[model samples]
Target: MKKLLTMFFTFLKIGAFTFGGGYAMIPLIEVEVVNKQHWIDKEEFLDIIVISQTFPGALAVNSSIFIGYKIGGVVGALLALAGVVVPSFFIIIIIAYFFLQFRNNLIVDLVFKGISSAVPMLILVAVISLSKSLKKELSTVLMILLTVIAISVLDIHPVLIIILSGIYGAVFLRKKVN
Candidate 1:
């Protein structure tokens, strides 16, 4: 019960203070979950990040659920997810209320422009972080290259790319356990 409360509060703090979404939350989560709380090791935490992206939800939400489950099972997952979402939900509602009022302000416009400029750098950092975490398997590397080329050069749908990659992995990289 105490551990669940701690997990909830920690994730709540993470969700509330973070801005610019999941990428911005990474460094903060690393400090809290890995360095401070010791809930998970660095490599395992990073692995969570990688696996979370393949899921359908936001990265932060998925990460919180996984960490919560790791710490204290299903009830912990519920608590952590509630902690992560509730603050953001209220904050977004508050912001949405005022955004219409300030939409035309020059300062607001400039701030939004500045944020847009930073988005690409944030995405690049996310890529770099994931790349550092990736195991250096030949098939994984080839799939990464193929996915990049397919998206960038061929303009293929990412779903199709992922599907093809999965087929390739199944056909060629299946492990044989004795």
Candidate 2:
């Protein structure tokens, strides 16, 4: 019970404080779950991030659920899921109620603009952090380069890229089970 409450509150803090969306919350989730709380190790956290992205729902919610299930069980998953979603639910409702009044306010516009500028940097930090876990091999470098090109230059859909990458890994990058 205590652990469940702790998980709920921790995720609540994460959801409440994160200004941008799931990508921007990656660093905070990593820090809290891996570094601060020791709920999971770094590699496991990265795995959660990858799995979360592969799913349909929000990254933060998926991550929280995965982490919670790993730590406790189904009950933990529910608690963590609620924790992460509750803040966003209330915040969105409040914003919806108030945004009409502030729609034309210059200060509101400036604030959103400032947030937009920071969101990219937050995502970059997540990318850099995740990249640090990759092996410094030629295949790794090539995969990274190709993935970037597929997304930016070829304008390939990311879901398709992920599916193709998984197939590529299974076919060519499989490790022998000893």
What lDDT tens digits, residue by residue, belong to model 2 across residues 61-177? Answer: 999999999877999999999999999999999999998999999999999999999999999999999989878989889999999999999999999999999998888888732
lDDT of 1 at 64: 91
Alpha-carbon shift of residue 102 in model 1 (angstroms): 0.7
The candidate that achieves the highest lDDT relative to the unseen native structure: 2
C-alpha lDDT of candidate 2 relative to the true structure? 0.93
After superposing candidate 1, which stretches have Cα over 4 Å from the reference? 176-178
Residue 125, candidate 2: C-alpha displacement in angstroms: 0.7
Clash count list over all predictions: 0, 0
- Candidate 1, lDDT over the whole model: 0.84
lDDT of each: 0.84, 0.93
- Tens-digit lDDT track of model 1 for 23-124: 777877877888899999878988798677678889889999999999989998899899889999999899899989998999989987988787567667
